[model samples]
Target: MSGTTLLINLAGSIALLLWGTHMISSALLRGFGTQLRQWLGQNLTNRWMALACGIGITGVLQSSTAVSLMATSFTAAGTLSLAPALAVMLGANIGSTLVVQLLSFDISIVTPLVLLVGFIVFRLRDDSRFESLGCALIGLGLMLLALRMLGATLGDVEGSAIFQLLMRSLDGELLLALLVATVLAWVCHSSVAVVLLIASLAGAGLLSPSTSMALVLGVNIGGALPSLVNAGSSVARRLPLGNFLVRLSGVLMLLPWVPLLAQPQLLGQLPPALLVVGVHSAFSLVLALLFIGLTAPLAALLTRLLPEPERVVDPGMPLYLDESGLEVANIGLANAAREALRMADMLSSMLSRVLQLLRTSEQANADEVRRIDQSLDLLSAAIRAYLADIGKEGISDQDADRSQEILMFVINLEHAGDILSTSLAQLAARRLRRGEHFSAFELGTLYPLHREVLESLSLAVTVFLREDLPTAHQLVNRKEVVRRLEAMASREHFRTLREDKSAWAESGDIFQRLLRDYRRVHHHIAALAYPALERAGERDINGGLVGDGLADAPDTIDRKEPEQCAS
Candidate 1:
């Protein structure tokens, strides 16, 4: 009867644990996903911040593996930089320790209360904040309840002859236990689950201390292996996986060095289960501390494992992600996507400047513009090729989608750059052919307007990146200013044509051509503004343009929505 009772409890606990964790993890992921992507785009200020974000994500999700895989895939996609991804992976190792800490404590008492409160909120909207809160609470409650039940069941079955024989059967065969643990972790697709199993067995005194330690080691190593396999051909991804294994190496080595299964620390004060988890997490912390200062050097080595990037290695990641960046776990993909986005931003900014230069017609300025244009082309081609190479690994569906979007965005902007690059020299030639061109006042109106349009471009890219709805809305008013100013200038030109028609009768063809060229330049600037404004979701900026048969556009941006104001 006791054996049957224990079996029932174990089954129930496992079911509850899995369900709760699933619920909470889903909620936390949804709540933070876009913001996480934003952070990935920005890539935290430095390595430490990346690590902290990784830890925070794993702590909330209760799964280090999830964070690591996400970061790794992002690295492959060229979204996140390699170094920050590695740093975050390191922090994820720390955050996953929280689960062990929780399981060590007595949490069964409040499980019922948590479930009751959580159920009350779960009925809310699927994406509502309250619904997410309920999911987290319920998941926590269920996991705690499971741990309590497992402890009770194990305590009841502790003295079973069958159990004792089975555990003692593996006595000194630590290698076998490690292999078993690794296989179990891979099969279950969760190291945390394996940890729980080992914890329960140890608590029942069914497994010896050395065997339990080996099991812990196996669980850690196995948890990271799947992602490594998934990385396939991505050097950026492989580097971080290598870093994780190397960090795990310290723990693996330490286990064999640990003394006496019968000692006080091993069995008397610290139970086998506590020792198992404590050893794994403690060693991770130690490894991080040991290697924290060595990050730059380690990063260089890991990065060296990959193909050399086209750009020179500066603190800036013009080419690839650092391995230290992806080690944190699930945050990998988002961070990598962000890096790709940043490169795209730089390219867009360069294109805008090229357009501004085209509006001017000086020989020196034209030459400078040519150099900048070549640089933009080289960088854009490099980034696009980089994203393509990175995407071959098993990146997540979302990240793959993001890659496609980013590629499309950059390609369109690149076309615009190409347009401007060739036009500048021609504009300069036309001015020289016409001989000093117009009055100083005419150049003043034209040049200042061109500069302002280019200056305004800085704001549009800022709005797209920041997702600032208010700023995006402000762009509409600014566009209006551009429109009226452009109209006023055209009117002034027509007046010049009427009043000075006789003086420039021979330059008649130049007048019409110049007017058409200038108007087209303004039209391109106005076109760039639509993407930023539409992303804000304020008004259909391009709906009017589209209705007038200008361009085919999507109703919503793939990853953004500005509720109330903007994210």
Candidate 2:
């Protein structure tokens, strides 16, 4: 083959290899992501267990980067401690090499059979699990086929003058080879693919043993870069940074010994393919053994290096929404859900301060409430945009529903915040300007109602997060309690107004307005229950179950309740 044609074929094989790796990673994530995360979270009791868990998970997923991201997110959320998280990263490095070891052998004979079964299983439309498995199988087949094609393509150019010159140059400049391989791995986002490509080059007699070993070390270093760059917070970045440090240290220790280790008496007795993969595998294994016990101290070092930033309140910017997560539906949905919960917390805080504002009419308190409300608005917009950016193509039905559910919850929260900042805050300001306070009786009536609203807010958050049917029932029931309390307070105000018309008129007006706004806020909060109840097969707004005959009828619950409450 001509040099140009050889280059094209080589590039195509490499691209195929990268694409196959992505398919396997994405498919596994879609199929069993929740279980993987839960398992990773539950088993992180100590460093040894965390190490085993990481090895098992990365072996299954065949992508250390995926494991790294998972560990980083857990660390960020405080689900996994820094020490255990470091251990997981160490195991992940070794797990990645295990995949390389398996792929380095001659398994092209099974490629056709794997692809056939994968295609058949993938065509089974009713079972998502089977479909995901099939996709993973197909990805595996493609990777094997690509490796075969790579060997063939390189063999055609193995004797070319230009290829020989390039290989000779890399043999002289080991650092240059390392740099090129590092860029390839970083850009491809798969060290496995890069190492496999190097193994193929070595097997094809296109690269010296030292050059292949140097490339392997480069891939090890490059594998850790993507997670560090994409991490969302300082805490999240630590695991990846620590992993990078470990790999860099290993490479530094081994760089000067490459020629010695690659000699015929040492590692060169094995076949070229085995030599390349053995070095890769042994390097990671040594690192894991050396650093596994030191994970705690390493974690401490990382913590000092990437210390948590002081908690500056940037309320308008989202703290949990991760843009990189949008590439994976599950991760994106998770990010949106976390941000929605944050919005709920902000709403709860605003509600708690509303009563204080009414009592004291303090300008500072009112400003804080307004600021939180503005932050809510910004977060609402950010979440909506983030969810919208998650591409619909390839997302499962469940994830799409979850995305919608989070969007609805945040919208309700934003509406409730508006009631606090706009309607209630203004009433408090009016009372302050007039140099009047709520009467003792008015405060007495309002206090219980405010307390109930706060309780209901808490319940609403619970329902939003858990979607528990019983809790949904209870939240919907609280709506009636809030309504009755508001009515009773209004009646009492009217009675006081009748006794002294001119004396009670202004305060009565403000009191009734406060009750109306509070009830409206409660309405938005209560709206959270309807969707949950509906999902549980309750057809009525009051959380009553109905038969299938009634299921098709227009929703008795106001799907647009939050927007109505806002209006």
Candidate 3:
């Protein structure tokens, strides 16, 4: 074949290899992502277990970059500590080398059978797990086929004068070869692909063993770039940065030894392809052994270097919504949920102060409540935008439902904050302006009702997170308790008004408004239980239909009676 044809064939084969790797990663993540994440999360008690967990996950995912992202997110969320996270990165490096080892052998004979089975399973299966498995098998077949094609294409150009000259020039210029390979790996975003291509070129006599070893070192360094580039917060970036440093250190330590190790006497009977793969494997193994025990110290150093930035005092800015998490559906959903919980917390703060504000009628308390409501508004908008950016592609049906649940929860919290800030705070301020105070009987009735709403807000948060059936039933039950409290308070107010018209008449309207606002706030808090109950196929909670009884309207507080309040 001509030189142009050979280059084109080589490019096509490399592209196919990259595509196959992507197929395996994406398919496995879609099928078993939650399981894998749980496994990784639950096993990080120590360095050894974390190291083993990383190896197993990276091997299954077929891409260390994916594993790196997972580890980074765990650390960023404060779920996993820095030491174990670094150890996982070390194991991920070794796991990637194992993939290269498996592909280095001649397994081309099984390629066709694998492809046939994969196509049948993928096309015929209705189950999503089966489809993901079949898709992964097909990717495996494509990888095998691409490697075979890559070797054959390089073989045809092995005898070309121009190829021979280029190989000869790289033989003496180890640094130049290393630089070239680093660029290739970084641009391709897969060290496995770049290393496989190098092994093929060495197998075809287009690269010397020493030059191939140098390229392998560079590939390791380049593999760490994508995670570093894509990381969002300093906490997220630390793992990738530490992984990069480890690879860079190994390269510097191994660069001088590459030529010595690749000498004919030392290389003995090993084929060039196996020799190149061995160098990659040995480098990773050495790094793992050296750095595994030092992870804690390294983590401390990294913490000092990448100190968490000073937090701004603005409560409006989102703390948990990391933009980088959006690339993974599960991570993005977790981020949105955490932000929703933050909104819930802010609403709780506003509610807790309501009774105090009403009792004291202080301007300071009212101002603080309004400020928290404004913060809730800002956080609600941020979370909505973040969920929208998570998008529909690659997200499972369950995750899409979860995204909606979070959005609904956030909307309700925002509505509750509005009631606290505008209606309740204004009523408190009006009482202060008119020098009106709740009588002993009025405070007695209002205190219990306010307390019930606070306890229900706590239950709402629990129901939102766990979606526990029993908890959902409990939360829905409280809705009835709140209704009875509101009705009793109304009856007592009328009784007081009739018994002493002048003493109660002036403040009676404000007191009644306070009772209605508290009930409305409880309704919004109780709305969280509806989705959980609906999912459990329990349409009725205490004789009330799920998602009924309340207005169910976003941000609207109806002034209707308790009977009409059933949404």
TM-score for each model = 0.45, 0.58, 0.57
**Per-residue lDDT tens digits of candidate 1, residues 1-567?**
467876677678656655666666567555554455556778664878887888887765556766776677666656567767777777887777776676566656667988898888877666567777787778767765665665565556555777567667866787777776776565444566568777878886777777777777777777777567656664646645665566567656766664464466645368677776776688668766766566667666777776645745432334444332343322443444465455445444544443334344455545554555566566567556656655644577655655564555455455545555576345545555456455544544455345544545555556545646555555445555555555566676677778875655544444434444544544454444455444445345435432222222223222221121110
Q: 329-375, model 2: which lDDT tens digit per residue?
A: 99888888888888888887786676667668588878889999999
Question: Which residue runs of candidate 2 sit more than 4 Å off their true CA positions?
Answer: 1-31, 42-101, 109-160, 172-174, 184-216, 226-233, 262-274, 308-567
Which residue ranges in model 1 land beyond 4 Å of their true spot?
1-34, 39-55, 73-80, 106-166, 230-236, 259-271, 304-567
**What value of lDDT does candidate 1 attain over all alpha carbons?**
0.60
Which 10-residue window of candidate 3 scores lowest in summed lDDT?
Answer: 558-567
Tens digits of per-residue lDDT for model 3, 150-229:
66775676567876687668886899988877876776566776787788778877788788888888899888987798
CA lDDT, every prediction? 0.60, 0.79, 0.80
The full ranking of all candidates by TM-score, starting with the best, is 2, 3, 1
Clashing pairs in 3: 548-567, 549-566, 549-567, 550-566, 550-567
How far off is model 1, as Cα RMSD? 16.2
Backbone clashes for every candidate come to 33, 0, 5
Q: What CA RMSD would you report for each candidate?
A: 16.2, 11.1, 10.7
